[model samples]
Target: MAEFSDYIVYVDESGDHSLTSIDPDFPVFSLSFCIVKKDDYTRAVVPSVQALKFKYWGHDAVVLHEHEIRKSKGDFTWLLTDRARRKEFYEDLNQIMVDAPITIIASVIDKLKLTARYPRPWNPYELALHFCMERLLMFLTSMGQQGKRVHVVFECRGKVEDAELELTFRRIVGGANQWGWVSRDFSVMEFEPKFAKKSVNSTGLQLADLTARPIAIKTLRPEQPNRAYDVILTKLGQIKEFP
Candidate 1:
């Protein structure tokens, strides 16, 4: 059995990776990896998110999904009735993010330019994953986590997608990437990927989910006033905007 690293990664994506029909408003796909040390995540981040949930919903079961929160749907319906409460909710959520000790590495891919440049463009999600994995290895190496197993948690997206993603992840770890550097030789870190349901309400996954869309919006419209992105920016360790 491999010794575990002190850190873990949670991944989430924003926007559809499909190129068949793109939404005019959003044409980019963004993938975010939220890396947090195990101790910090359990000691601080988990409590903070739970506190917020308890204060708002009286329970810790509600998942902090960006789309549902934005649309004031289901568990977030209270936001629709009270505007001041809505403002307060956002403020609280932003404070949690600002205080959390998370290292964010992301890839935002512009599908329009990608399709234009390559007659047969690669899947944006796979491309983003490749980029993120390379950076993740670099980060782990820098943190002196070589030869340790680091678990990466991802939201379950059904059987076929999960199987495909697992294959892609293994291939990347096997060194079939743009850099051509073997993971064992260069990175010296063993990656363990797991699929999780949102219902599990993992704090790391929820944070990653909140992170992805704000990044996509910022990349798509840099000049736009994005308070959420402003808060998220403070936590970003590295971000790549792909051509």
Candidate 2:
């Protein structure tokens, strides 16, 4: 059997918490995750994403615009909009999807409700981030039941007391171990802002931001089912929309 180190999981986030500050009418907050196995990293994900860029922009380069992919606008829209090309693109994407082991998780938050619940004027981005990380950890614990260890690599939010995040992660990991959800020696590694940028592009982060947009739009009429869209809604207070 392959060891957990034989695979790599990279995670990232999208959208700004201060959308209301920019455009008070259109506030959106979102978090996203994108996971890939180690062997598939070089063989499938990298090449397929590069192909996706080429197919969309007629050039092979690293594309980082979340709105382009999320909104399917501009060239991205063109690629998916074109019938023959869209078929080819989806074919390639399906091949990559089948070849690689991947999973995506996201949470969307309604900022107005979040403010009413917390009312501390704290950094909403950080709050949403912690919620994303906690849920990701929980999912990994549940998936590790097949005697497989999970190695997680996530982008770090540049904050002073982020050490607390590490400590909290360890505690949760310990609890998962006690429950036999994971082995006693699993590990997590966080990347600096620079390296994270060069690593895998996170689609989950983009999805999270997208999920948050609608809820923020519907702040005047919030519903309970909207809260259930996110996995961390109960703990974080009606902030996330999950898919």
Candidate 3:
């Protein structure tokens, strides 16, 4: 077995899994996994992001969230009214994404076409989770870290929903089916998934959330100019979206 680092993969979602709430123009669901070594996350990623927040607001309590930054809402009210400052702060955060020591693996589901093509399609969240986990394991394998285990941490929706998500992830890890059989052999992720709300102060989840929207935007609006996303496109895995 290959050696592996103790790592944590944080997954944050952009867009919804609800077929009913599908936006005709942007009907895509995206889940992004930001993988980092446990030690590096604490010694590097966390403090770096903290510095960025402090640089802007001079406060440690402020968190970096993509949607909130874009709309300039919530704790980011100061940024809302100041276009120049917001633009500068946003650029610095993107630099953090580039310089951070991590890997990005994501799955984007084209919900509008998925439901149309299949009368009974697979659940979007579950589908994305399956593919993302596979890619993460593959990444470990490629690095010759087959023996190192990775755990997935998801942003919570609620107690009930979070429990359901955890169960599904455990089942997947158990290799309950054909795909599971492959994961079982790889043996990279064997731990039960963790679900903590974003308010729990997880820098990893914050990073994942920051990256998820740019991915959704690129997938939903290919024609639009998105230089920020272009900067991180190289990190995206090769998993294709479902039809």
Candidate 4:
């Protein structure tokens, strides 16, 4: 029996949900759960991230978004022209990831395989989320806290998708869906899963965003170099790959 901590998981996704426009180079849709103790995020992680942001942009209003940072666009535009600054900032960012007390649970959807398996496929995002929940249940069971509670924080996209996702989660957790009634040994999560929105100032969601792309890159190209994934490998709890 393992002791459990009061944890919250922040979920962020990478890659496209559209089946028609699937990029061959990156066909996988990925979701990453950036989990930390509730208080640790507020105490250590939040302050540390704010300091890092201030060091680069000199303002709290400026936030880190993965696409912008990856392409060096948006507030990161200067990174495109300044190789030295880009290198420095990336290194510092990597170090911050290394120091943060967090864990990642990743789910990857293989779009090519998914299409071949189904006449019409489930939403890739939902598929990945389901896989992550299975692992989350197992993780909690292993911790000897089959009755412990945990909350999940998701980034807000829009009302329609959000409402749909909430329904999906409830079905999954309540054994109203496939992942539930079928798996008797892992019947239910340690606790009934709770959810909340990612605050604008949330550093955990930002961390989750940073993790999503590198994981997509690594899953699509296992032979390729991926130092970003390496930084979190020790902290990665479970990585689920779906058809």
Which candidate's lDDT is highest? 1
Q: Where does model 3 exceed 4 Å of error?
A: 1-5, 178-189
- Write down the TM-score of every candidate: 0.96, 0.52, 0.90, 0.86
Between prediction 1 and prediction 4, the one with superior lDDT is 1
Whose TM-score is greatest here?
1
The local distance difference test score of model 2 is: 0.47
Candidate 1 vs 3: which has more TM-score: 1
Which lDDT tens digits does candidate 4 get at residues 132-215?
Answer: 877777766665556556678788777887788788877767665543336434444433343445446577788998999888
Q: For every model in order, what is the number of clashing pairs? A: 0, 8, 2, 1
**lDDT score, residue 23, model 3?**
84
Per-residue lDDT of model 1, residues 1-243, tens digit only: 679999999999999999899887899999999999999999999999999999998999899999999999989999999999999999999999999999999999999988888888888988899888888988889999988999999999999999999999988887776534444443488898999998898889999999999999999999999998998899888899877
TM-score of predicted structure 2: 0.52
Can you write out model 3's per-residue Cα lDDT over 9-115, one digit (the tens) per residue? 88898888988788887799988888888888889899899999789878778767888877778888888678898788878888888788888888899998899
Could you give the candidate ranking by lDDT, starting with the highest?
Answer: 1, 3, 4, 2
lDDT for position 116 in model 1: 88
TM-score of 1: 0.96
- Sorted on TM-score, best first, the list reads 1, 3, 4, 2
